[model samples]
Target chain A: MMTKEQILQWLEQFADAIAQNKEYLTQLDAAIGDADHGINMDRGFQKVASQLPKLAEQDISSVLKTVSITLISSVGGASGPLYGTFFLRASTAVAGKQELSNEDLASLLQAGLDGVLQRGKAQLGDKTMIDALSPAVTAFTQAIGQGKTTSEAIQQATAAAEQGMQATIPMLAKKGRASYLGDRSIDHQDPGATSVYLMLKSLSEVLGMTSD
Target chain B: MKKLINQPEDFVRESLIGMAKAHSDLLKVQFEPTFVYRADAPVQGKVALISGGGSGHEPLHAGFVGRGMLDAACPGEVFTSPTPDQMLAAAKQVDGGAGILYIVKNYSGDVMNFEMATELARAEDLRVLSILIDDDVAVKDSLYTQGRRGVGTTVLAEKICGAAAEKGYDLADIADLCRRVNLNGRSMGVALTSCTVPAIMKPTFELDADEIEMGIGIHGEPGRERMTIKSADEITEMLAMSIFEDIVYTRTVREWDESKGGFVDVQLTNPEWEKGDRLLAFVNGMGGTPLAELYIVYRQLADLCAQQGWQIVRNLIGSYITSLDMQGCSITLLRLDDEMIRLWDAPVKTASWRWGS
Candidate 1:
């Protein structure tokens, strides 16, 4: 079971990763988007980071909900509502869970993917955050179904997410500002997909380190 | 990157503070969830007109908040859509017991946030209706992209609709007039350079000295095509022809149905423009472009419309809606009926646009 402390660590790790790669992500977006993906995500997560302290003693669901609210209010782009709904739905799935079991984690990720799908109306291969997140959730669910530990499941999910992000390099975007590029959108990695990969990677790192 | 701002993060807020102070006689600033409301808001027995978007397009939302324009304007971060809380609060503060009409642009972020605000405001039992202004003909369709963005036409819609509300038109009539304004308007723009978002402190796109991005949107999104820089008349012809050649565009948008107490989708179609139609020609500068250049564009646009047998009955040439420091201009051709011309000529006293008082 993943403890509340681990959840908190995951959020911090995600925030730190976003802060570190902020320029790189913005550069990726500059190629095809409005060139503010990194800036927007960083702004949102920074607000979530500040609110994390007050949410430390709360239930895992409550903690995630707080992050969702902070991100929604602060992010202010396609990413804002998409990621906010992600966490909000995940929070609902894990409602009342102080610690998450493998199945609970799988459910949380799946719920997030579903929420993003509903919010963005993006399907697989749409060259959006869904490209990474959809695969990550499926991998986590499959890993957990195979009796894998939370750490192992998250590791598998992160690997799939990385692959999914890279696969967006050849996609013609069908949604968001990037879609304005049409064929020109091809050959560039989607910044949203890259950020989603970072999210899973951060979560995997937290769970894997705790397992060690 | 070389801007006159004290801090990068405080860019939007600081500008808003300056605007509030500068326009104190006409408007007042509200904090927490920042919004600029009319100095004498909650105008009893009038349908309130509320409009907002990302802040950099100065004189658009905030500057237009005054006597006969928007009742309130919510300014988001540089090129970022404002959150629903700001709109909800603005709606609560400005709702004059008649209703509130939200004029939203066609950007996905703006559409989604306004949708949420409409839902929340309705939940609070405040009457509300929303109409989207998507008149940019740069993008072709909604099938593959976010569709045509709302650009020059949005400013015109606000001005016309705000006047309609001032004339004591009910919420439904105001919403219909706003939608009609959007339907009859079409705009296209070009960019000589890209603008930098202050927080990022870098240009969104790089353009070579000789190259121009044609059909550019307000947010510096790449246009339909890029080409070598041409004469003002040639560029004006390019923008004008695109609008003239555009087919009848149709799309479905959402609106709040007070009687049904839920949202309903309304199919809207912008009709084809016929020859000899009287039009309101607007030549707008994209921030960095000078007035001399805008007049050059307007001169070309006026000539082209006349060549095509269209009459320029009324014209507004200036920097009404702008991309921050992007050196370019957009031409908007809005077909005007008798009612529209009457509303367009009505008195408006705003910080940016004031006449007929």
Candidate 2:
């Protein structure tokens, strides 16, 4: 079981990771986008991080709902609503739960992915956050179905997410600002997918340490 | 990196403060959820017109909010779309019991946020309609892509639609008029230099002195191609010809469906210009370029129109819409029918653009 403390740690770690990789992600976006992905994500996540202390008294569902509201209001781009919806749907899936079982975690991941897919309307291979997030959710559900622990399942999900993120490198972008580049969009790693990978990796790290 | 800013975070707010102060008689600025609304907003029974997008494009959504223009304008951070809360607040502030119309640009963030705002407004039992402006001929329309980016034509649509609203056009009729304006317009721009967002503190892209990015959008997003810079006449010809020769571009757009109480996709096709068509030619400076340069561009554009037997009945030459300090310009050619011509000639009073009463 993953406790509420682990969820808080995962968020804190993910915020730190975003701060560290901010410039790198911005650089990646400079190649094909407006070059503010890192700046925008960091702005939103830092706000989420600052609110963690206040969320301590809240249940898991409420905590995640607060994060979603903050992200949606603070992050002012396509990623804002996309990530906000993910958290909002995840919160709904885990309503009233203070901790998550493996099955609950799987449901959470699936709900979040479904929200992103519905919000962005991006299918697989469209070169978006869905590229990483869809595979990660699938891998997590599969591992959980085979009797894997939450940490092991998240580990498998992170690995799948990494591979999916890399696969975006050569895609001709069919969505977002990069789509304007046409053939020029090829060969640049998608910034949204890269950020999604970081999110899953941070969750895996927090869960892995707790399991140990 | 050199910019006239106190702090990167306060750049947008400070500029907005200055604008609100300067135009106190025209509009009022609301903080926190940051939106600018007309001073005498909630005009009795008038359909409220609201529009928004990222900052840096001055005299756009915000500067154009006044009599005979937008009722409210929500500005996000520099190059970022405003959140749904801002739009919802603006709608509530300006809705006059008739309805609300949101003039949204076709950027991804702007689209999603405005869509959410429409839903929120509807949930509160406030009638709202949204019309998308996507007239940039630069991005090729396709099923896979998000279609074209809305550019210069957005300004024209706002002016025309605002005039229609002032003339007591109903919510649905004004929505159709906005859609009509978008269908009749096409634009293409060439960027001579990359613009630096204040937060980023560097140029969005780097270009050598002799190179120019053709078909660029207003946000400094990379355009169709980068090539060696040419003379003023050649560049104007390139931008103008692309718009003039563009085919009947078709794309799907979402608008509020009153019967379903939600958005529904509608395919729209831009009309092809024939000889002897009346045109409203706009030569817009992309922030850094001067009026003299834009006039020179307009000269070339006017000559091209005359050569092709298209009559340039109306023209607006200056920087009305802009990217931040990007040394470039865009050419927009809008075919005008009788009603559009009358609306274009209608009285408008705003901070950046005003004429007649």
Candidate 3:
């Protein structure tokens, strides 16, 4: 079971990952996007970081909901609504649960992915966060179904997410600003997909520490 | 970035504060989710027009907020679309009991945010309608890309739709008028240099001195292709022909259905332009380009229109909508009917644009 501290750790670690790679993500975006994905995500998560103190004692759902609201208000790009909706749906899925079981974690990830798909209208291979997130959720659920621990399931999910992010390379974008590039978008990894990978990686890192 | 900014993060907020001070007689500022509205807003029994987008596009959406223009304008972070809260608050502040209409651009963020705002406004029992302006022909395919980006013609739509609202048109009538304006408009732009987003403190894109990005979007996104620089007349012919020789564009967009109380998808097509069509010619600089350069562009644009047998019945030539410090220009040709022509000529008293008052 994932404790509330683990959930907060996931958010804090995710924010740091975004902060560290902000310029790199923006550079990836500069190839085929508006060159602001990292900046926008960093701005959103930084606000989330600042609000963590007030959310520490709250339930996991409350913390997730607070992060969603912060992102929805601060992040102004396509990433904003997409990520905000993800957390919002995830919060609903795990409502009132102070600690999340392996199955509960799978449900949370799957619900977040569903929210992203609905908000972005992007399917697999659309060169969006769905590219990474869809496979991550699938892997997480599959591992959990096989009776893997939460830490093992998250590790599997992060691996899938990394592969999904790399798979974005050579795919022509079909949505968002990168879609404008058409043929020119080939050979560049999607910024949104990269951020998704970072999120899953952060979650796995947090789980590895707590469960071990 | 050598800008007159106090801090990178404070750019949009400080600018709004300055705008409130500068245009105090015309508009007032609201905080939190920032928006600008006419000082004497909620004009009784008037269909209020609300529009907004990123902050760097000066004199657009916000500067155009005054009598006979937008009743309220929401400004987001530089080059980022505003949130639903901002739009929702703006609508509530300006709804004068005659309903409200939202003029949204076609970018994904703007479309999604405005859509959410429309739903929220409907939930509040506020009468609201929204129409999108996707006039830039920079992107080629609607099914493949995010369709066309809204560019120069948004300013024209705001002016015309704002005027229509001032003439006591109801929400539906004004919404239809705005849609018509979008359908009849086409624009194409070229960027000579990239602009810097204040927070990022770097140019969004890089262009070699000898090359130019053609078919540019308003937010400094790269265009369809890049080519070596050409003469004024040559570049003018290229940008103008992109619009003039463009075929019919068909795409699906969302519009607010008041009866259904939700958004419904509607297919829209750009009306093809033909010879002898009376056009409102707009030559807009992309911020860093000087007025002299814009005039040169306009001169060539006029010659080309005359050659193509199109009549320039009215014209607006300047940098009204811009990318921050980007050196470029866009040309918009909007087909005008009698009603549109009359509305375009109507009096508008805004902080940035004023005439016939």
Q: Which candidate number has the best lDDT?
A: 2
Interface RMSD, one decimal, each candidate: 1.2, 0.9, 1.2
Question: Rank by lDDT, descending?
Answer: 2, 3, 1
Q: Kindly provide the TM-score of model 1 when superposed on the true structure, using C-alpha atoms.
A: 0.97
TM-score of 2: 0.98
List, residue by residue over B146-258, the lDDT tens digit for candidate 1: 67789999999999999999999999999999999999999999999998878777788888889999878888777768899999989999999999999899987777777
- Over A1-212, each residue of candidate 1 has an lDDT whose tens digit, in order, gives 79999999999999999999999998898888877788889999988877788887799999999998888778887888888889999999999887888888888988988988876777788799999999898998898889888889889999999999999999988888887777888999999999999999999899888762
What's the C-alpha lDDT at position A136 in model 2?
96
Candidate 3 iRMS, in Å? 1.2
Error of 2 at B76 (Å): 0.6
Candidate with the larger lDDT of 2 and 3: 2
DockQ of each: 0.65, 0.78, 0.65
What's the lDDT for all of these models?
0.89, 0.91, 0.90
- Model 3, residue A193: C-alpha shift (Å): 1.1
- For model 2, residues B1-357, the per-residue Cα lDDT tens digits are 699999899999999999999999999999979999999998989999999998989989899999899999999888888999899999999999899999999988889889888988999998999999999988877576878888999999999999999999999999999999999999999999999988888899989989999999988788879999999999999998888779889988788899998888898898778999999999999999988999888888899999999999999998888999899999988999999988888999988889997
**Candidate 3 lDDT, B130-201, residue by residue in tens:** 989999887888898878888888999999988999999998999999999999999999999988888777
Docking class of 1: medium
Best by TM-score: 2
